[model samples]
Target: MKRGEAAEDFPPLSPKACILSSRSGSRMNSTELGHRLIRHYPFASESLLNERGIGIYVPPSYYRDENKRYPVLYMHDGQGVFGPNPFSNSSWNVHRTAEELISEGLMEEIIIVGIDNYGQERLNEFAHPLQSSGIPGAPDIICKGESYERFLIEELKPTIDGLFRTLPDREHTALMGSSMGGLVTYNIGFRNPHIFSKLAVMSPYFVRLDLNTLREIPFYKRYPGVNNLALWLDIGEIEANILVEHVRGVVEELIEQGFVFGQNLMYYEVPALRIPRRIGQPECDRRCCFSSGSRAKQLKPSCTAEKKSD
Candidate 1:
């Protein structure tokens, strides 16, 4: 991926979309809608990503502690994280899970930055090795994981750390995503192990699993410091046919490279999830496992934002 201009090159977000919604709402049952609020930033940036949206979730503890610093989890596919997906009309309810986990002391209060995917460019941005398309009007060149990774590590991470009271280190930073988002999460997180210490990839989309792709990663040779990195990789047994075999191959390769289970890696093959396209159940247990590297964790997104209601 090529380097681009600075933040000024991108357009500013819109007022309406950037509306900081109020978190002052009544609580609902866990199965009901997520009670946590989402702060949307429309037109967040188009430099390397889609100039569409950026959603942020702050955990409850953010308001209680003024001097505490927290870890950060960068998630892909912003629209599906907290709000209703226009297509599925369902969300992962990330906020609700975080709230419950934090209250129960099962998870540490952390920040979640949901990076939105571009419409037509979503595949390119999340492409692991620059895949191409057959549809008409599609660009002849069809890969963009590199540029997208740069956007997250170089641009987004810096801005977030500087703004939020965060533990700004690779050990404290994590990546989470499902499907295509999972694909990119694997790409970016592993490629920059020095930048991201943990990852939760759900049903990662890989058309094929090949050793060549694995060889290209430049794994330990580049960043040997994180060989013991924490990873949570999973796939539903009922997942689409294309994902099943590929996930296995990826896992096998990861193991060959010294990623052990229980110590630095966690892999699960379970029943179909509520929203197989996005995440697991609504209990927040899956969310907790993905964020904290421990099956025993969860979080609240209350980050560095000036605690205010919209």
Candidate 2:
């Protein structure tokens, strides 16, 4: 038998094993994974920014047509976007989700840019500089969110726009993530409204040590006047209530700042089981997640967002 055909010719040990082997044979490899993924890595020039690389997901059709321009969504927890790896138990299955969405035409074809985090510095980089009390075990580390934002706006965005035919306007730009990444989604969207018009925050880590400082964010003052911004906020009910409450507090502040519930903001609490397999890995025991958005015109709010507010 030929070397490539050897496996196909091998005798099966048992019916069950045969089935399992067949399934394993169909598994995707890294290159195959890359093709299935809209992959791109853009460099950053900011100092101390080691993980300045980003992975972008363009739908399969994106490669076939040169004239297509797609919306752009920036996601955090780069390693967790595609599949479970040795380093992470949970993944967003972003590639699979994007493929499905593109196939269904439910959403406009989009470009997903996964921003890899600098592990130890992730917490610091994602949190606002003034908000630091809630993050445990990192009292001395100063927040670098401002610098991180600069890297995205001044460096990453321009690079992505230049390389790909993306809709480079605020209405088409979005930010998303879970946990700390979720928090950053809200912070970045609100802080830089001109750049990001859509915000998706899943299971945000809002209970940081300095939650109080977020109240002073300037976006709060400018939110009401902002147009075309949509917000999607979802949280798991069984995860950590402290985090949920913190998210609620932030939403309240935004509301107080003049954002209408269902107009500029949409929030949801998803069950642990139904929580998208990608966002919470099979091993993750938490049962809920949360998210937010800015552009109301572009988003068709999910059913979960209509749930009663806490």
Candidate 3:
């Protein structure tokens, strides 16, 4: 096996064994009640940020087929993924959307892991001065994004791989998030291309930052072109004009660095998303194919805006 690749015939740990390894974690009900969502509460970390619960959504065929291994998508904002978000009463309905796509044979069956954000510390955990020019309603200073990165790459990924039957290679692994989470996904995806090959960055919080700030970001400084990485960048149609311009700027920058418009890079202006703050399930539905190794151009033209800009 390669550095990140998993053995095809490797056996998965029993659910009881998996739960026992994490002293602070508890296993919730599995496929017993037509529920495929698994919750591991207080998923303790070794030396990173505070421990938080994580939601893992196994595909419909996960439990039935013991020998099969699937790709994994690690998403931020776990609480709002499968269920309604407490803050806005809206959700991405990721599990529902994934099941639909898989049933229709639109994408491959994959595991979706939602990592919950630390409530008030979300900005501190997701935002970094090097990654952002400023975090609205918060001071523009250093943050613990590096620690957050270590938590995901070191603690979370390893734990998930050990517990689940996952195809843990870079090509099969992806990172996804919206807003601040989107910003960090973009940061982490490019910085560690060896770990993650796909990124779904919806409505990233680029704010009113200028190109100079974006150019100074560590990923841009280090990577001339992330052609090996697939990225999906988008914004709500009702969002502020500045945000649209910000995403456009980032798209242009990525293009300059060798990211093709309809190949590995995708930019969209989602008109169906009426609420600027809420992440739409349709967008999640569209991005499902990305995890299955589809190109960005395969997404619906109703949401894609690459031709207009080019």
Number of the top candidate by TM-score?
3
lDDT of 3 by residue, 1-310 (tens): 1224332332345664343244644544332112344554467655453667777777877767989999999989887877777888877777777777777777888998988888888877786545455433335445777788888998789878877889999989999988878888988888899999999988877664445555322211235656689888888777766666677777877888888877788777888564544755667767778756754334863223444555
Worst 10 residues of 3 by lDDT: 1-10
Worst 10 residues of 2 by lDDT: 283-292
True-vs-predicted CA distance for residue 43, candidate 1, Å: 4.7
127-146, model 2: which lDDT tens digit per residue? 76543353344465567777
Candidate 3: deviation at residue 274, Å? 5.3
CA-only RMSD, every prediction = 12.8, 11.7, 7.1
Candidate rank order under lDDT: 3, 1, 2
Between prediction 1 and prediction 2, the one with superior lDDT is 1
lDDT of each: 0.62, 0.58, 0.71
RMSD of 3: 7.1
Q: CA shift at 130, candidate 1, in angstroms?
A: 6.2
Alpha carbon deviation, residue 307, candidate 3 (Å): 7.0
* Model 1 lDDT on a 0 to 1 scale: 0.62
Distance from true location, Cα of 222 in model 2, Å: 11
